[model samples]
Target: MPELTGWAWALLALAAVVVGLSKTAVPGAGTIAVAIFAAVLPARQSTGVLLLLLILADLFAVAMYRRHADWKALVRLAPAVVVGVLLGVVFLWFADDVWVKRTIGVILLGVIAITLLRRRLQAGAGADTGSHRIAAATYGSLGGFTTMVANAAGPVMSMYFLAARFEVKAFLGTAAWFFAIVNVFKVPFSIGLGIITVPGLLIDLVLAPLVIVAAFFGRWLADRMPQQLFEKLVIVFTIVGAVYLLVS
Candidate 1:
């Protein structure tokens, strides 16, 4: 493990908690954790470390919301997502750390823009009624690529679910199962690429409890939050996290 200062440890711990919170409460909030982890550790290494924590949170989320998943949505997204993940792996194999960071930053900003545009359209008319293939190819590709590269798929997937007009529980349930399966899929790729390591696993072990605590806290908060408020918070946090990534 890299020797981290007390402050770094604290930041990472907070980021871990955010991962759990993001999974259970605010879907896009994981972007903040991504930015923090990337800031404190080497970009690729941070991605590796964060992945384990995300999966830990995913487990909690799946346990809570597994039955609510939209299996049709998952099936629609699977093929395109797989392609995107493979592309991301290819990119990771060749890209340096600076490129990785900048790419993530760019992806964050792009997702924010796309999400806002879709929301505006939804408000002006009705929800998007594009073909399922198009939606799957578009969002699923981006979601898979971003998650594979930066563990930053939360915003992309959130936008998709929102556009799909999923009710709160359905949204959480679909996202929970989607990421649980997706993150697990990424593990071998991450390991083969050396993004995941024994040291990263050790760090995750220390932070696991915090993730559990935050997951339940998030569940409580989500249960109480109004739908509109929940949506707004996700957008706001996504914007904040994107800006942090670009400027940091």
Candidate 2:
């Protein structure tokens, strides 16, 4: 384990809780957890650590929302996601820690931009009806790449679900399954990259309970929270996280 201060551990615990919350309630909000982990650990190491935590959270999400998943959508996106993940692995092979951090920062900003653009287009077009195949391929590839690179694919996937006009529960359910499967798929690759270390695994074990507790809490909050307010807060926090990553 990298020698971290008490404050860094505290922040990581909070981020772990956020990871669970994002998995269950706010779709794209987990990017904040990604940002915090990256800021506190080496960017590459952070991806591995966050990936395990996310997989832990994913179990709860899948259990809570598994019945609501749209299997057809998952099937549609699978091939493209694989392609993007392979591309991300290639990118990771050559990029050093500094490049990884900067790339993550850039990706965060791009996610935010893509999210905003999605909302605007949705408001104008109202529930995408043009091309499901095209939409699935585009978003799937982007989601795979972002998740692989920085664990920042929540917003990208959220946009895709929104475009598909998924109901709230369905969106959550689909997202839960999407990440559960995808995160597990990435494990071998992450291991191959030598980023998933014993120290990181130890840290995940220590923080696992918080993630579990937060997952339950988020499930309770899922239906009750005001969507517009939650989304706005997520966007603000995401921007702050992106800036910090860029400048730090």
Candidate 3:
């Protein structure tokens, strides 16, 4: 591992907690860690290093929320997201992170805008009106592309669940499985792209423990909060994370 300054070390620990909590508990918080990686590491190595960390987080998310997945939704978004992953790889090759960051920021803000508009349009939606096939396709493509390029998956996917009015557990569970499967698939590609190095992996070893603790803590917190409050908290963080990405 490179000899990180103490401040960078603290940032890494904070990022680790964000990753675990996002995967296992809050569905939209990983954007902060994505920002952390982009800010702390080199432009190229950040994704590779963060990819490994994300996979670790995915494991914990799967273990905690495995039984509660929405398989049908997974099936619905799988093909599109796979296509997105492919496009993302190509995008990475051609686009500098200036474009990538701007692109994802636009996407995040767009989703948040859409979510707010949707709520205004349908003030009391208990469920979608089966008009969500196109919605699924849109979010899937954006989610896959943003995630692959920037590890910014949370907001894109969160928009989908929010619009569909998923109950809290269902939203979190589906998100857990979705990212777990997709992030694992990204491993070889990340390796091929020369993102993960032995040194970076070593750094991951130190941060991994924080991830585990945060996952458990997130679960504890989630179980204790009222459902409405949890949903509202998610919305607030999503807005914050999205805005931060746009600004940073």
- Please list the C-alpha lDDT of all candidates, in the order they appear: 0.87, 0.84, 0.82
Instruction: Report clashes for each candidate as comma-separated counts.
Output: 0, 0, 0
Q: When superposed on Cα atoms, how far off is each prediction in RMSD?
A: 1.8, 2.4, 1.6
Which lDDT value does model 2 have at 188?
Answer: 96
- Tens-place lDDT digits, model 2, residues 22-81: 999887778789878977887778888999999999999999999999999999999999
Off by over 4 Å in 2: 104-130, 230-245
Q: Write the per-residue lDDT of candidate 1 for residues 1-248, one digit (tens) a residue.
A: 66899999999999988998999999999998998888888777889999999999999999999889999999999998999899999988888766766776777678678767767766756644465568788889988988898898888888788777788889999999999999999999999999998888888888899999999999898788889988888778877776776676
Off by over 4 Å in 1: 122-130
Better of 1 and 3 by TM-score: 3
Q: Say which candidate scores most in lDDT.
A: 1
Q: What TM-score does model 3 achieve against the real structure?
A: 0.94
Preferred candidate (TM-score higher): 1 or 2 = 1
Compute the lDDT of residue 98 as modeled in candidate 3.
Answer: 81
